[model samples]
Target: MKKNIKNKLNNLKASDNYRVRRAKDSGNSHIFRFKGNDYLSFASNDYLSLANDVRIVESAKKALDIHGYSVSSSALISGYSRSHMLLEEELSNFLGQEKTLLYSTGYQANLGVIKSLASRGSFIFADQLNHASLIDGSILSRANFKRYEHKDVKELESLLNKCPDSREKLIISDSLFSMDGDFAELKELEQSLKKYEAKLLIDEAHSLGVFGYQGRGLVFEYLLNKNENIFLTGTFGKSLGTFGAFFSGNSDIVDYVMQKSRGYIYSTSLPIHTIEATRASLKIIEEEDWRRDKLFSLIRYFKNCIKKSNLTVLESDSHIQALLIGSSADAIFFSDELMKRGIYLPAIRPPTVEEGKSRLRISLTVDHEEKDIDYLINILDMISQNLVQ
Candidate 1:
């Protein structure tokens, strides 16, 4: 029976693709060691390098003294605490929203928001390239979920028009496309949705601390009406360097999510220490504007370096920069070659990216230096030339 199960597992693996996690013992940066080789990691989501900050560590330790390790239950049960409430208040004020609700992860936030809002007879218009969590939530919502082409306002408008006149409609999109790192046309989307009288939802999982004047993401970046019927979701796992997610909107939406969103109602709340750490991280993001500036400068620096290398790179103003290699085998080979050179960049292939457009996703942070960027450029230049040869 065990042999049969192993054969079934092997068959399942052969049917698609499988990926394994490599161990690392360090904080955020492009350079890390794994399997006894040092590799330049261009793949972490810690955009601001606040995850391992000393100040955050101190705050977390303080909270641990006050709140203990685990809450032992979901927030609705016995997990709600003063620390969680304080962070919610801070997040609400920071985002200019009426209220904010927290979840254990960004994926759960997306799932809770979609599954709770769009129900039977409701319509949900999602971007073609929305995150898998959003897609899963829409499917599980039992609503008439429609996907428009990515960033196409006209396509979204047309789909909204086709929905029954009496049906409630919600349009969902990522403010920053994670894989591509391009921003959504929020102004156009807002206008189009208003024409159809449908509400809009923006997931700022990649934009929370990385965009806008005050780092409020695209909502403020485009000057959208703050008190309008728009929903915004952000994650601490990325820029905030914490381990939870939050959704902000009107108070009623918060109440509804708290009461009805299964993902939130059932899941355990984030640790109190994490909440305190996240609050401190947000302060760092606001007080240390230089970090953001440094991040952008590094992005520009790296982009220019790649351009000087005469390599084709995706047009991205965000922290994520990808180099299209066009085949999984090619991408894997490039990543392996870079690893052998003591520079690590993991291969991103089909499922994460399209089969024909396999590319290297490079995540930049303030922790990386000018020399690190230069070394990466040199390595990529050599790899590109050899691949062409």
Candidate 2:
């Protein structure tokens, strides 16, 4: 037993990648108290900066008062609440879907969708750069999995042509890529799916409340809102700045998952307070369009600044901006130096990205001001000119 574990542990240590934990004080932005120094983070996925929003917090508190704490059992086992039902209804209306099914997390939602849909002989066509959750879910489905080049619908068409006529096909992808900030070509992909008569599953983890009319998502933004064979999975963790997740589709599909998906059936549901806060966050996204505008403004400014510094900015037209630093050591050093100057963004390294492509994944929020962008620009310029050395 000792010998069996020793080889695996030793391999991890030898890889220059021993994972560790650091405590963070989550109540503030630009003020993570770790190891006696405050660091401003760009690593968090809270894009709208609504995690600490006063109204959301108050709504959560009110829900706690009304609903109390523990959801002592699964939703099927008496854990379901009025707030959960309301949120599900609101999501269905917002997404223009016939129904929605809530889950404990985005990861679990992806798993449930794939495991339930992709049967033996079914084909799962995926984007090469899709999130790990989608990949894991497809593998777990016991289906014939095929991956195409990222955002290349032509390649996807070719793959679809090759599949045997005996099996059903499901194509899965991210609406907005998590790391690269690139977007899927929705219209083209839809055309390919039509040619093959395949079902589509889109994970809108990064795009919801960031694109489309009233931030409904990329699906609505692109006028693909009424596709009957399309399915969508989204999370409150990103733009909504809350917790939990949901999947939206035709009423039949949603009901089937509700009755059959093991991930949904086995797990306890999200707390009442979390559901209430997510509801409040969605309300804010609907009524306040200016936040989306402000985010785009900052994105444009940052891109212009990155260009002036002569740094390579990857081709991403979304809120995520990657400044390629090449080597992991250089990326790590650059992140550390920025922290020393009271600016913080982590170096995304191998496994998170392809080797030799480590980068600084700078994310913008509605709460970040023009001045913050200016400061980041100055620091990046200084680093490029070798001043940080």
- Relative to the true structure, candidate 2 has a C-alpha RMSD (angstroms) of 1.9
Query: lDDT per residue, candidate 1, 1-389, as tens digits?
Result: 99999897796456333565778866465557676566667777888888889999999999899888998899988999988999999988888788899999989999998888889889999998888888888899999989998888888888887888789998999989888888888888888777888888889999888787657777867766363778888889998888899989889988888888998988888999999999999888878888889999998998888878868788999898888888777887888898888777787776777668888888998788878889888988888888788
Worst 10 residues of 2 by lDDT: 24-33
- In the range 266-304, model 2's lDDT, one tens digit per residue, is 999999999999999999998889988988888888778
Error of 1 at 334 (Å): 1.1
Off by over 4 Å in 1: 1-16, 35-38, 225-227
Per-model lDDT:
0.84, 0.86
RMSD of every candidate to native, in Å, equals 2.0, 1.9
Per-residue error (Å), model 1, residue 325: 1.4
Screening candidate 2 with a backbone cut-off below 3 angstroms (N, C-alpha, C), the clashing residue pairs are none
Q: Give all TM-scores, in the order shown.
A: 0.95, 0.95
Q: Which ten residues in a row have the lowest lDDT in candidate 1?
A: 11-20
For lDDT, the strongest prediction is: 2
